[model samples]
Target: MLRAGQAREDIKVVSFDVDGTLVSPGFVDCVWLQGIPKAYAEKEGLSFEQAFEYVKSEYDKIGEHRIEWYNIDYWLRKFDLDIPYERLFKKYEDEIMIYEEVESVLAVLEEEGYELILSSNAANEFIEFQIEPIKRFFSHVFSATSDFGEVKKTNGFFARVCEILDVKPQAVVHTGDHWVFDFLNPRKIGITAYYLDRARKRNVTDEVRKEDDEFVISDLSELLDDPDC
Candidate 1:
Protein backbone atom coordinates (compact mmCIF):
# COMPACT_ATOMS: atom_id res chain seq x y z
CA MET A 1 0.00 0.00 0.00
CA LEU A 2 2.89 2.37 -0.56
CA ARG A 3 1.76 5.69 -1.96
CA ALA A 4 2.97 8.65 -4.00
CA GLY A 5 4.40 11.80 -2.45
CA GLN A 6 1.27 13.34 -1.06
CA ALA A 7 1.54 13.11 2.70
CA ARG A 8 -1.36 14.46 4.66
CA GLU A 9 -0.64 17.93 5.99
CA ASP A 10 -2.12 17.12 9.37
CA ILE A 11 0.39 14.31 10.00
CA LYS A 12 3.63 16.19 10.01
CA VAL A 13 5.90 13.67 11.71
CA VAL A 14 6.22 9.92 12.11
CA SER A 15 8.23 8.64 15.05
CA PHE A 16 9.60 5.11 15.52
CA ASP A 17 10.83 3.20 18.53
CA VAL A 18 14.08 1.34 17.82
CA ASP A 19 14.11 -2.07 19.44
CA GLY A 20 11.51 -4.55 18.24
CA THR A 21 10.03 -1.97 15.87
CA LEU A 22 12.53 -1.04 13.18
CA VAL A 23 15.28 -3.24 14.62
CA SER A 24 14.93 -6.83 15.78
CA PRO A 25 15.59 -7.82 19.38
CA GLY A 26 18.54 -10.00 18.26
CA PHE A 27 21.39 -7.48 18.54
CA VAL A 28 20.26 -6.11 21.89
CA ASP A 29 19.76 -9.63 23.15
CA CYS A 30 23.32 -10.35 22.10
CA VAL A 31 24.54 -7.25 23.94
CA TRP A 32 22.71 -7.77 27.24
CA LEU A 33 22.22 -11.54 27.28
CA GLN A 34 25.52 -12.69 25.80
CA GLY A 35 28.16 -9.95 25.63
CA ILE A 36 27.81 -8.58 29.16
CA PRO A 37 27.64 -11.98 30.82
CA LYS A 38 30.57 -13.25 28.79
CA ALA A 39 32.64 -10.31 29.90
CA TYR A 40 31.51 -10.79 33.49
CA ALA A 41 32.41 -14.46 33.32
CA GLU A 42 35.93 -13.68 32.09
CA LYS A 43 36.46 -11.01 34.72
CA GLU A 44 35.16 -13.10 37.62
CA GLY A 45 36.83 -16.30 36.37
CA LEU A 46 33.43 -17.97 36.62
CA SER A 47 31.42 -20.08 34.22
CA PHE A 48 29.33 -18.17 31.67
CA GLU A 49 26.17 -19.67 33.16
CA GLN A 50 27.11 -18.54 36.65
CA ALA A 51 28.02 -15.07 35.41
CA PHE A 52 24.69 -14.83 33.57
CA GLU A 53 22.78 -15.63 36.73
CA TYR A 54 24.61 -12.99 38.76
CA VAL A 55 24.35 -10.37 36.01
CA LYS A 56 20.61 -11.00 35.56
CA SER A 57 20.07 -10.70 39.30
CA GLU A 58 21.91 -7.38 39.40
CA TYR A 59 19.96 -6.12 36.40
CA ASP A 60 16.69 -7.09 38.11
CA LYS A 61 17.72 -5.15 41.20
CA ILE A 62 18.00 -2.03 39.05
CA GLY A 63 14.96 -3.02 36.95
CA GLU A 64 13.79 -1.64 33.61
CA HIS A 65 12.24 1.42 35.26
CA ARG A 66 15.71 2.78 35.98
CA ILE A 67 17.97 4.53 33.47
CA GLU A 68 21.02 2.50 34.55
CA TRP A 69 19.30 -0.72 33.51
CA TYR A 70 19.56 0.35 29.87
CA ASN A 71 23.08 1.76 30.01
CA ILE A 72 26.03 -0.28 28.72
CA ASP A 73 28.70 1.94 30.26
CA TYR A 74 26.96 1.87 33.65
CA TRP A 75 26.82 -1.90 33.62
CA LEU A 76 30.43 -2.22 32.46
CA ARG A 77 31.58 0.04 35.26
CA LYS A 78 29.28 -1.52 37.83
CA PHE A 79 30.60 -5.00 37.05
CA ASP A 80 34.12 -3.62 37.05
CA LEU A 81 34.87 -5.48 33.86
CA ASP A 82 38.39 -5.37 32.43
CA ILE A 83 37.04 -4.65 28.97
CA PRO A 84 35.81 -1.34 27.66
CA TYR A 85 32.17 -0.71 26.60
CA GLU A 86 33.30 0.30 23.13
CA ARG A 87 34.77 -3.16 22.66
CA LEU A 88 31.34 -4.68 23.07
CA PHE A 89 29.97 -2.30 20.48
CA LYS A 90 32.72 -3.22 18.05
CA LYS A 91 32.42 -6.96 18.66
CA TYR A 92 28.66 -7.02 18.27
CA GLU A 93 28.53 -4.65 15.33
CA ASP A 94 27.75 -7.60 13.09
CA GLU A 95 24.81 -8.62 15.25
CA ILE A 96 22.67 -5.60 14.44
CA MET A 97 19.55 -6.83 12.69
CA ILE A 98 16.90 -4.47 11.36
CA TYR A 99 13.44 -5.73 10.55
CA GLU A 100 12.74 -6.74 6.92
CA GLU A 101 9.95 -4.30 6.22
CA VAL A 102 11.64 -1.35 7.91
CA GLU A 103 13.34 0.09 4.80
CA SER A 104 10.25 -0.17 2.62
CA VAL A 105 8.05 1.37 5.27
CA LEU A 106 10.46 4.22 5.86
CA ALA A 107 10.86 4.80 2.17
CA VAL A 108 7.11 5.04 1.64
CA LEU A 109 6.64 7.39 4.57
CA GLU A 110 9.61 9.49 3.48
CA GLU A 111 8.39 9.58 -0.11
CA GLU A 112 5.02 10.75 1.18
CA GLY A 113 6.84 13.69 2.82
CA TYR A 114 6.31 12.69 6.45
CA GLU A 115 9.22 13.78 8.62
CA LEU A 116 10.74 10.60 10.04
CA ILE A 117 12.27 10.45 13.48
CA LEU A 118 13.51 7.78 15.88
CA SER A 119 12.64 8.25 19.54
CA SER A 120 14.01 5.39 21.62
CA ASN A 121 14.76 4.49 25.24
CA ALA A 122 18.09 2.99 24.19
CA ALA A 123 21.49 4.56 24.72
CA ASN A 124 22.53 7.06 22.06
CA GLU A 125 25.76 5.24 21.09
CA PHE A 126 23.96 1.94 20.70
CA ILE A 127 21.22 3.62 18.67
CA GLU A 128 23.74 5.32 16.42
CA PHE A 129 25.71 2.17 15.79
CA GLN A 130 22.70 -0.03 15.10
CA ILE A 131 20.89 2.31 12.73
CA GLU A 132 23.92 3.20 10.59
CA PRO A 133 22.42 1.79 7.41
CA ILE A 134 19.09 3.55 7.73
CA LYS A 135 20.23 6.69 9.51
CA ARG A 136 19.83 8.79 6.41
CA PHE A 137 16.08 8.12 6.44
CA PHE A 138 15.61 9.89 9.75
CA SER A 139 15.94 13.61 10.24
CA HIS A 140 16.28 13.35 14.02
CA VAL A 141 17.16 10.71 16.57
CA PHE A 142 16.17 11.29 20.19
CA SER A 143 17.21 8.95 22.95
CA ALA A 144 14.81 9.38 25.84
CA THR A 145 17.11 7.88 28.45
CA SER A 146 20.35 9.33 27.08
CA ASP A 147 18.99 12.75 26.10
CA PHE A 148 16.07 13.51 28.41
CA GLY A 149 17.08 11.56 31.56
CA GLU A 150 13.67 9.90 31.36
CA VAL A 151 12.34 6.67 29.94
CA LYS A 152 10.07 6.49 26.91
CA LYS A 153 7.02 5.88 29.11
CA THR A 154 7.35 9.31 30.65
CA ASN A 155 5.31 12.21 29.27
CA GLY A 156 8.34 14.46 29.68
CA PHE A 157 10.26 12.58 26.98
CA PHE A 158 7.43 12.77 24.45
CA ALA A 159 6.70 16.38 25.34
CA ARG A 160 10.35 17.28 24.94
CA VAL A 161 10.40 15.62 21.52
CA CYS A 162 7.33 17.58 20.45
CA GLU A 163 8.89 20.82 21.68
CA ILE A 164 12.14 20.17 19.83
CA LEU A 165 10.34 19.11 16.65
CA ASP A 166 7.99 22.10 16.91
CA VAL A 167 4.94 19.93 16.45
CA LYS A 168 1.83 19.27 18.49
CA PRO A 169 1.16 15.80 19.86
CA GLN A 170 -1.77 15.32 17.50
CA ALA A 171 0.42 15.98 14.47
CA VAL A 172 2.63 12.97 15.23
CA VAL A 173 2.33 9.23 14.79
CA HIS A 174 4.33 6.73 16.83
CA THR A 175 4.68 2.95 16.68
CA GLY A 176 6.47 0.45 18.86
CA ASP A 177 6.11 -3.00 20.43
CA HIS A 178 5.62 -2.01 24.04
CA TRP A 179 1.96 -1.59 24.89
CA VAL A 180 2.31 0.96 27.65
CA PHE A 181 5.36 2.92 26.58
CA ASP A 182 4.60 3.18 22.86
CA PHE A 183 0.82 3.07 22.72
CA LEU A 184 -0.72 4.33 25.94
CA ASN A 185 1.91 6.96 26.75
CA PRO A 186 1.73 8.72 23.36
CA ARG A 187 -2.06 8.44 23.19
CA LYS A 188 -2.28 10.06 26.62
CA ILE A 189 -0.89 13.21 25.01
CA GLY A 190 -3.12 12.83 21.87
CA ILE A 191 -0.45 11.45 19.51
CA THR A 192 -1.76 8.95 16.98
CA ALA A 193 -0.03 5.81 18.21
CA TYR A 194 0.09 2.20 17.08
CA TYR A 195 1.29 -0.78 19.09
CA LEU A 196 3.40 -2.91 16.73
CA ASP A 197 2.91 -6.40 18.13
CA ARG A 198 4.64 -8.39 15.37
CA ALA A 199 4.00 -11.68 17.12
CA ARG A 200 0.32 -10.99 17.81
CA LYS A 201 1.04 -11.98 21.38
CA ARG A 202 -0.55 -8.89 22.86
CA ASN A 203 -4.30 -8.37 23.48
CA VAL A 204 -4.09 -4.59 22.92
CA THR A 205 -5.77 -4.73 19.52
CA ASP A 206 -8.78 -6.56 20.99
CA GLU A 207 -9.06 -4.07 23.83
CA VAL A 208 -9.06 -1.14 21.41
CA ARG A 209 -10.93 -2.85 18.57
CA LYS A 210 -14.25 -1.38 19.57
CA GLU A 211 -12.90 2.11 19.11
CA ASP A 212 -10.00 1.73 16.67
CA ASP A 213 -9.30 -1.63 15.13
CA GLU A 214 -5.96 -0.50 13.72
CA PHE A 215 -4.54 0.31 17.11
CA VAL A 216 -2.30 -2.77 17.05
CA ILE A 217 -0.49 -4.26 14.04
CA SER A 218 1.37 -7.53 13.58
CA ASP A 219 3.60 -6.11 10.85
CA LEU A 220 5.25 -2.80 9.95
CA SER A 221 3.70 -2.96 6.49
CA GLU A 222 0.33 -2.65 8.16
CA LEU A 223 1.16 0.96 8.89
CA LEU A 224 0.97 1.66 5.17
CA ASP A 225 -2.50 0.15 5.10
CA ASP A 226 -3.77 2.97 7.26
CA PRO A 227 -4.22 6.24 5.41
CA ASP A 228 -3.46 8.47 8.36
CA CYS A 229 -0.37 6.54 9.49
Candidate 2:
Protein backbone atom coordinates (compact mmCIF):
# COMPACT_ATOMS: atom_id res chain seq x y z
CA MET A 1 0.00 0.00 0.00
CA LEU A 2 1.20 3.49 -0.87
CA ARG A 3 1.41 6.10 1.90
CA ALA A 4 0.69 9.78 1.55
CA GLY A 5 3.45 12.30 0.61
CA GLN A 6 5.21 9.57 -1.37
CA ALA A 7 5.62 11.27 -4.69
CA ARG A 8 6.73 9.41 -7.76
CA GLU A 9 8.24 11.91 -10.13
CA ASP A 10 7.95 9.74 -13.23
CA ILE A 11 4.21 9.15 -13.00
CA LYS A 12 2.29 11.94 -14.70
CA VAL A 13 -1.28 10.72 -15.15
CA VAL A 14 -3.66 8.51 -13.12
CA SER A 15 -6.58 6.61 -14.66
CA PHE A 16 -9.33 4.89 -12.65
CA ASP A 17 -12.23 2.49 -13.14
CA VAL A 18 -15.55 3.62 -11.67
CA ASP A 19 -17.67 0.74 -10.37
CA GLY A 20 -15.59 -1.27 -7.95
CA THR A 21 -12.69 1.14 -7.69
CA LEU A 22 -14.43 4.37 -6.71
CA VAL A 23 -17.83 3.30 -5.44
CA SER A 24 -18.46 1.85 -1.95
CA PRO A 25 -21.15 -0.85 -2.29
CA GLY A 26 -19.82 -1.16 -5.85
CA PHE A 27 -21.87 -0.73 -9.03
CA VAL A 28 -25.19 -2.51 -9.04
CA ASP A 29 -25.77 -4.88 -11.94
CA CYS A 30 -29.33 -5.22 -10.65
CA VAL A 31 -30.17 -1.65 -11.63
CA TRP A 32 -30.43 -2.87 -15.18
CA LEU A 33 -30.87 -6.58 -14.59
CA GLN A 34 -33.63 -6.90 -11.96
CA GLY A 35 -35.19 -3.58 -12.85
CA ILE A 36 -35.72 -4.20 -16.54
CA PRO A 37 -36.45 -7.90 -16.23
CA LYS A 38 -39.00 -7.36 -13.46
CA ALA A 39 -40.82 -4.78 -15.56
CA TYR A 40 -40.87 -7.19 -18.49
CA ALA A 41 -42.08 -10.06 -16.30
CA GLU A 42 -45.04 -8.05 -15.03
CA LYS A 43 -46.27 -7.62 -18.61
CA GLU A 44 -45.97 -11.41 -19.06
CA GLY A 45 -47.82 -12.28 -15.82
CA LEU A 46 -44.70 -13.33 -13.91
CA SER A 47 -43.04 -12.16 -10.71
CA PHE A 48 -39.86 -10.05 -10.67
CA GLU A 49 -37.81 -12.85 -9.16
CA GLN A 50 -39.05 -15.33 -11.80
CA ALA A 51 -38.32 -12.81 -14.57
CA PHE A 52 -34.81 -12.20 -13.25
CA GLU A 53 -34.13 -15.91 -13.08
CA TYR A 54 -35.42 -16.46 -16.62
CA VAL A 55 -33.38 -13.55 -17.99
CA LYS A 56 -30.29 -14.73 -16.15
CA SER A 57 -30.78 -18.20 -17.55
CA GLU A 58 -31.15 -16.79 -21.01
CA TYR A 59 -27.93 -14.82 -20.41
CA ASP A 60 -26.10 -18.02 -19.46
CA LYS A 61 -27.36 -19.65 -22.63
CA ILE A 62 -25.73 -16.88 -24.66
CA GLY A 63 -22.42 -17.33 -22.78
CA GLU A 64 -19.85 -14.65 -23.70
CA HIS A 65 -22.45 -13.05 -25.95
CA ARG A 66 -23.82 -11.72 -22.65
CA ILE A 67 -21.09 -9.04 -22.60
CA GLU A 68 -22.11 -7.67 -25.97
CA TRP A 69 -25.79 -7.34 -25.02
CA TYR A 70 -25.40 -6.35 -21.35
CA ASN A 71 -25.98 -2.62 -21.73
CA ILE A 72 -29.10 -0.99 -20.21
CA ASP A 73 -30.97 -0.24 -23.43
CA TYR A 74 -30.07 -3.65 -24.86
CA TRP A 75 -31.49 -5.54 -21.87
CA LEU A 76 -34.63 -3.42 -21.82
CA ARG A 77 -35.36 -4.21 -25.47
CA LYS A 78 -34.28 -7.83 -25.13
CA PHE A 79 -36.80 -8.40 -22.34
CA ASP A 80 -39.48 -6.68 -24.41
CA LEU A 81 -39.81 -3.90 -21.83
CA ASP A 82 -40.97 -0.59 -23.29
CA ILE A 83 -39.82 1.72 -20.50
CA PRO A 84 -38.15 4.96 -21.55
CA TYR A 85 -34.42 5.42 -20.85
CA GLU A 86 -35.04 8.45 -18.67
CA ARG A 87 -37.25 6.55 -16.22
CA LEU A 88 -34.73 3.75 -15.93
CA PHE A 89 -31.91 6.23 -15.47
CA LYS A 90 -33.74 8.16 -12.75
CA LYS A 91 -34.79 5.06 -10.82
CA TYR A 92 -31.24 3.90 -10.22
CA GLU A 93 -29.61 7.31 -10.00
CA ASP A 94 -29.61 7.51 -6.20
CA GLU A 95 -28.05 4.11 -5.80
CA ILE A 96 -24.70 5.13 -7.34
CA MET A 97 -22.49 6.27 -4.44
CA ILE A 98 -18.72 6.69 -4.10
CA TYR A 99 -16.59 4.93 -1.56
CA GLU A 100 -16.17 6.85 1.69
CA GLU A 101 -12.43 7.45 1.29
CA VAL A 102 -12.31 7.96 -2.48
CA GLU A 103 -13.03 11.69 -2.54
CA SER A 104 -10.32 12.58 0.00
CA VAL A 105 -7.71 10.39 -1.67
CA LEU A 106 -8.57 11.92 -5.03
CA ALA A 107 -8.16 15.38 -3.55
CA VAL A 108 -4.72 14.53 -2.23
CA LEU A 109 -3.64 13.09 -5.61
CA GLU A 110 -4.93 16.16 -7.41
CA GLU A 111 -3.07 18.38 -4.94
CA GLU A 112 0.06 16.43 -5.82
CA GLY A 113 -0.35 17.38 -9.49
CA TYR A 114 -1.48 14.04 -10.85
CA GLU A 115 -3.81 14.37 -13.85
CA LEU A 116 -6.84 12.22 -13.06
CA ILE A 117 -9.04 10.53 -15.66
CA LEU A 118 -11.94 8.09 -15.49
CA SER A 119 -11.94 4.94 -17.61
CA SER A 120 -15.10 2.95 -17.06
CA ASN A 121 -17.11 0.13 -18.71
CA ALA A 122 -20.44 1.59 -17.61
CA ALA A 123 -22.98 3.19 -19.96
CA ASN A 124 -22.86 6.97 -20.47
CA GLU A 125 -26.04 7.52 -18.46
CA PHE A 126 -24.91 5.29 -15.63
CA ILE A 127 -21.41 6.69 -15.71
CA GLU A 128 -22.86 10.18 -15.70
CA PHE A 129 -24.78 9.45 -12.51
CA GLN A 130 -21.84 7.76 -10.80
CA ILE A 131 -19.43 10.65 -11.35
CA GLU A 132 -21.81 13.49 -10.60
CA PRO A 133 -20.75 13.63 -6.96
CA ILE A 134 -16.99 13.54 -7.58
CA LYS A 135 -16.70 15.16 -10.99
CA ARG A 136 -14.53 17.95 -9.68
CA PHE A 137 -11.70 15.52 -8.91
CA PHE A 138 -11.31 14.37 -12.50
CA SER A 139 -9.92 16.10 -15.55
CA HIS A 140 -11.83 13.83 -17.95
CA VAL A 141 -14.14 10.79 -17.97
CA PHE A 142 -14.19 8.22 -20.78
CA SER A 143 -16.97 5.68 -21.07
CA ALA A 144 -16.31 2.30 -22.66
CA THR A 145 -19.61 2.61 -24.53
CA SER A 146 -19.34 6.15 -25.88
CA ASP A 147 -15.57 6.63 -26.03
CA PHE A 148 -14.16 3.30 -27.12
CA GLY A 149 -17.32 1.41 -28.12
CA GLU A 150 -16.06 -1.42 -25.88
CA VAL A 151 -14.36 -2.17 -22.58
CA LYS A 152 -10.84 -1.03 -21.61
CA LYS A 153 -9.52 -4.57 -22.08
CA THR A 154 -10.05 -4.26 -25.83
CA ASN A 155 -7.07 -3.64 -28.11
CA GLY A 156 -6.24 -0.01 -28.89
CA PHE A 157 -8.24 1.34 -25.93
CA PHE A 158 -5.17 2.03 -23.78
CA ALA A 159 -3.32 3.31 -26.82
CA ARG A 160 -6.10 5.82 -27.46
CA VAL A 161 -5.87 7.03 -23.85
CA CYS A 162 -2.12 7.52 -24.12
CA GLU A 163 -2.60 9.50 -27.33
CA ILE A 164 -5.30 11.63 -25.78
CA LEU A 165 -3.30 12.34 -22.63
CA ASP A 166 -0.14 13.02 -24.68
CA VAL A 167 1.86 10.72 -22.45
CA LYS A 168 3.66 7.44 -22.93
CA PRO A 169 2.01 4.31 -21.57
CA GLN A 170 4.86 3.88 -19.08
CA ALA A 171 4.12 7.23 -17.46
CA VAL A 172 0.56 6.50 -16.35
CA VAL A 173 -0.79 4.38 -13.49
CA HIS A 174 -4.25 2.81 -13.79
CA THR A 175 -6.06 1.68 -10.64
CA GLY A 176 -9.07 -0.61 -10.46
CA ASP A 177 -10.46 -3.60 -8.55
CA HIS A 178 -10.74 -6.16 -11.36
CA TRP A 179 -7.44 -7.97 -11.84
CA VAL A 180 -7.94 -8.87 -15.51
CA PHE A 181 -9.63 -5.72 -16.77
CA ASP A 182 -7.75 -3.17 -14.65
CA PHE A 183 -4.24 -4.43 -13.90
CA LEU A 184 -3.11 -7.12 -16.34
CA ASN A 185 -4.33 -5.55 -19.60
CA PRO A 186 -2.85 -2.11 -18.90
CA ARG A 187 0.40 -3.62 -17.61
CA LYS A 188 0.71 -5.47 -20.93
CA ILE A 189 0.59 -2.11 -22.70
CA GLY A 190 3.61 -0.89 -20.62
CA ILE A 191 1.56 1.18 -18.18
CA THR A 192 2.20 1.01 -14.43
CA ALA A 193 -0.78 -0.65 -12.73
CA TYR A 194 -2.32 -0.84 -9.27
CA TYR A 195 -4.87 -3.39 -8.16
CA LEU A 196 -7.41 -2.10 -5.63
CA ASP A 197 -8.38 -5.22 -3.67
CA ARG A 198 -11.34 -3.62 -1.94
CA ALA A 199 -13.58 -6.69 -2.00
CA ARG A 200 -10.56 -8.85 -1.08
CA LYS A 201 -10.92 -10.88 -4.30
CA ARG A 202 -7.78 -12.91 -4.75
CA ASN A 203 -6.00 -13.22 -8.07
CA VAL A 204 -6.03 -16.90 -9.02
CA THR A 205 -3.67 -16.42 -11.98
CA ASP A 206 0.11 -16.33 -11.71
CA GLU A 207 0.39 -13.15 -13.75
CA VAL A 208 -1.80 -11.13 -11.39
CA ARG A 209 -0.58 -12.66 -8.13
CA LYS A 210 3.07 -11.98 -9.00
CA GLU A 211 4.48 -8.57 -8.21
CA ASP A 212 6.02 -6.90 -11.23
CA ASP A 213 5.34 -3.22 -11.91
CA GLU A 214 1.92 -3.69 -10.34
CA PHE A 215 1.03 -2.51 -6.82
CA VAL A 216 -1.87 -3.82 -4.72
CA ILE A 217 -3.68 -1.85 -2.03
CA SER A 218 -6.76 -2.62 0.04
CA ASP A 219 -7.81 0.99 0.27
CA LEU A 220 -7.08 4.26 -1.54
CA SER A 221 -6.08 5.78 1.82
CA GLU A 222 -2.88 3.78 1.60
CA LEU A 223 -1.87 6.05 -1.26
CA LEU A 224 -1.90 9.06 1.02
CA ASP A 225 0.48 7.33 3.46
CA ASP A 226 2.88 5.54 1.10
CA PRO A 227 6.17 7.23 0.17
CA ASP A 228 6.18 5.61 -3.30
CA CYS A 229 2.69 6.70 -4.33
Tell me the alpha-carbon RMSD of every candidate.
3.1, 3.4
Indicate the residue-level lDDT of 63 in model 1: 96
At residue 8, give the lDDT of candidate 2: 57
lDDT of 1: 0.84
Report the C-alpha lDDT of model 2 over 75-153, residue by residue, as the tens digit: 6777777887678667776777788898888888898888999887766767777778898888888776666777445
Task: State each candidate's clash count.
Answer: 0, 9
Off by over 4 Å in 1: 1-8, 204-206, 225-229
Candidate 2: misplaced stretches above 4 Å? 1-7, 25-27, 61-67, 203-214, 226-229
Q: What local lDDT does model 1 show for residue 16?
A: 93
- Which run of 10 residues does model 2 get worst, by summed lDDT? 1-10
TM-score of 2: 0.84
